[model samples]
Target: MADLVTEIRERALALGFDAFGIAPAEARPDLGDKLAAALAAGWHGDMDWMAETAERRASPKALWPEARSIIMLGINYGPDSDPMAMLARKSTGNISVYARNRDYHDIIKGRLKEVAGLLSRRTGAEVKVFVDTAPVMEKPLAQAAGLGWQGKHTVLVSRQFGSWLFLGAIFTLAELPVSEPMAESCGSCRRCLDICPTNAFPAPFQLDARRCLAYLNIEHKGPIPAEFRKAMGNRIYGCDDCLAVCPWNKFASETREAKLFAREDLREPPLSELLALDDAGFRALFAGSPIKRIGHGRFLRNALIAAGNSGDAALLPAVEARLGDGDPLVRGAAVWALAQLADGERVRRGAEAHAGGERDADVKAEWAAVLPEVV
Candidate 1:
């Protein structure tokens, strides 16, 4: 059994995973209770799937009854530069480091499948692998596997690799000996909690996805709520403030995966250039990038919010051009941008022209809503 575990760990490292561990496939008794509390508090927000797969997600045994052991892996993709610096550069679109290169879902899934195939051949063990796309409770599972503890930010923070790990899991019918679970090392540290722009953390180790900029910019569809827009600053994709402030990050090695390297173009894209993208243009710009999955409408909505917060009056022309955009989401975001860029008079005049022709109820309310704030 020790030989099998040693072999699996060695193969994971050779395959580009920075860390590896194993956990029993038994159901975590506390996971289901914590999940129920979070759902009851509405912290899961608009991600309805969390509620839908509650039973399966909380229990590995429930997810795969035959699974007797689980293997956990981490890929370190730490940034070469300070991710927080981009926030002050309001003219540029701040894309999270993870999305600046190849979509990790594709990259990690391919690697997991490769390793799973090898393991199945070696041990004749039935195995299944997963990245983030599934309902797996990867953070807790990874902790139980001795990979890392869940930091106050609710992300896995490895003592060896820090906050910059992308996690994946494999379920196998073989009962490999379990590794000792990682101990909590976040004693007397609150940098992650203090750094949140939207006050997303209700307490240490808890997050409200409804107020999270990462959630708003990515998973969320339609117009962003007014309260979170300005706090979002120039971030057009996701937020990383909490992760960057972690002291554990110093131990993280630079990403070895060429596919995960930050793309020069996405590092700090000019907000004006990002605003120029129409539907076809958006698709072309983000092709093969995870940003493409959001589609043009939602992407444009985020770009427009960044434009409004940009404080660049020069962006007014680009903001106005979207008033008549085909998508209501884009148009609503544009209206908000206009209210921010232009003064009360210009915004009112622009609203009068578009309000009559604009058919979407949300767009109409958007123009109606912003008028009072500027006035």
Candidate 2:
């Protein structure tokens, strides 16, 4: 069993996984209660799937009855440059480091299957694989497997890889030797909590997804709640404040996988280019990226919010063009953007022409709320 575990670890490393560890399927007995408490507090925001998968998500055994041991793997995707610095370039969009390249789920899952296949062939054990798509509580499981510990901001922080690791898992019927769990090492540190633009972290190690830019800009379906627009700044796709601010990242290095490196266009795409994207253009641009999951309307909605915050008069025309967008969500964001960038006459004219024809209550509300101020 020890020899087999050693062979599997070497195989995983050869295949490009940066971190590997094993844990018993029942290693995290505390997850269910923790999940219940967070769900009860409504911290998950519009991601109702967290509640839907709670039972299966909280338990590896529940997810697969035959699973006796679990293997956790991680790929380091540390950025070559400071992600926070992108926020200053308000005319550009700040995509999170993880999404700057190809979708990690697609990259990690196939490699995980290869490692799982090796284990199954050696031991004749049934196996299952999961990435972020499944309800697999991967961070806690990764901590349990000694790859890292959950940091103050609730993201897994590796001593070697820092907060830049992308985690995946392989579950097996074979009872492989479990690795010792990592101890929390973030004593007297609150950089991640302090750096959050929207105060998403209510306390150390706890997050309210409702206020999280990552959740708001990505998972959220409706218009961004008004209060967070300015704070959202130029972060069009996802927020990296918490992860990038971690001190542990000082020890981290950039990703070894060429496919995981930030694409030249995605690193700091001009907000002007992103704002001009139609559905087909958005599809072609983000074809292999996780950003495409949000679709063009929401992507434009986020860009419009960034434009409103940009204070750049140059984006006024792009913002105004979105006023006639087919999607009310996009049109409403454009209204808010116009209020921020355009003068009173331009905004008033927009309201006079479009507010009357606008059928969406939310768009009407946007006009009503801003028209009083502009006038």
TM per candidate: 0.96, 0.98
RMSD, model 2, all Cα superposed?
Answer: 1.4
Q: Write the per-residue lDDT of candidate 1 for residues 50-162, one digit (tens) a residue.
A: 99999888888889989999999999988888999998998889999889988888878888888788778888989999897777899999999999999999999998778
lDDT of 1 at 102: 84
Q: What overall lDDT, based on C-alpha atoms, would model 2 receive against the true structure?
A: 0.92
The models' CA-based lDDT, in order, is 0.88, 0.92
Tens-place lDDT per residue, model 2, 242-270, is: 99988888777633445367999999898
Q: What value does the lDDT take at residue 65 in candidate 2?
A: 79
Alpha-carbon lDDT of model 1: 0.88
Point out the worst 10-residue segment of candidate 1 by lDDT.
252-261
